[model samples]
Target: NSTKPVIYPFNPNFITDYKGYKLGMSVEELDKLFAFRKENKYVNSAKEFQTVTGVSDSLLNAISPYFKFPDWVNQPKKQYTSYSNNKFENKKPIVKVDINLATQEDLIKVYGIGPALSERILKQKESLGGFVSMEQMQFIWGLSPEVVENLNKHFIVTAEPKISKVDINNASVKELAKFPYFNYSIAKEIVTHRSMNGEIKNIEDLTKIKGLPSEKIKIIALYLEF
Candidate 1:
């Protein structure tokens, strides 16, 4: 027999038969989930999970609270936004956020950023200590331009991290590569250039390294000092 579930969040896609049973899912529902998995498909939301599993509303309400989805699936969208201006067209302005200081909990309040996306944004921020510029938001994987624009509506980069840079003149290739922006290959190239030429003077110096992404010079520049 399956024991009752303690209150905690879990990915609904990972639900096994025992987990389903304990969560009060019918055999039919479990079968549907199993079949869906065998076909390599997914259920994105609580509403969709109910539709697929044919569960009662009561069961769905109880189980849905724990249905964690992959970041892409649960990102809220604006499909129903009315072009016709109504009461909402002239509502009070939202309080703006300094994104550098905002926590995971604060990010979740944004329409598109659910728990998963919030963590992703925070994780990326933590890697760089904090954002040096709002433009760096583009580097975060899976954040759509529309979603980014929505974030910009309320959030701004009001603070900058005191980023301690890898001194290419003295640091090893492994040390330089530890920055998310630099790969081992590029890190090695930077070190080689430093050995043959001298200390990398500026962003222009980094561009001379092959395999260093041409597009990333601006963002990469932020994480380095002399």
Candidate 2:
């Protein structure tokens, strides 16, 4: 949104006239519309107005020649702030997100979430039945309270996630690495170790790996399915 308020001249001499055109709009309406146009135009140009609003080039050209804002237009006096500022500062309502319902890219778009955090959110969603409220986001390992609160401002829970049942016994090293806690090396170790031993007998086997600490194991376990 534009931070500058719309400027208009107090004197009417700055107004321009075009043949057969009517300034039927009141001054207040025109000022409001002008401000709206300045902030909302997807394409910021005279040509865009011509193309989208069906205003002809010739009409635009005629208006262009007459275009002159009064002296006051050149000296803006006040700042423009969106009304959302006050509303945003208040505690937002709890919103639920189905981790399975979100695309990885969508998850990343959350305020405090990056690729790693997104993966963790997805994994947790899969492990549990899916998030029931914004609070569930905090369950993901390493997700901070501040980050969760920050995200609450922008995200809402809408639908249930569609979790894929991962066969830990058959999943590839690359697939395992996609888990938030297990990066390339850790995922690779799990795959290699499993290949040698056949299949993991239980979730506890994960902790037996040298570098796989209990904390990391618990996080990985959150998303794993038999």
TM-score each candidate. 0.61, 0.37
lDDT of each: 0.77, 0.55
Off by over 4 Å in 1: 1-75, 78-90
lDDT of 2 by residue, 32-63 (tens): 43543433222234454345445556666744
Write candidate 1's Cα lDDT for 1-226 as tens digits.
8865486888887888887877888898899988765544566779878877889998888778877886655433433244324776549687788888888888876656778888989988887777887776666775655567778887897767777776766879888888887889988898889888888888888889888877678888877877
- Model 2, poorest ten-residue lDDT window? 11-20
In order of listing, the candidates' clash counts read 0, 2
**Position 158, candidate 1: lDDT:** 74
Candidate achieving the largest TM-score:
1
Angstrom error of the Cα, residue 17, model 1: value is: 39
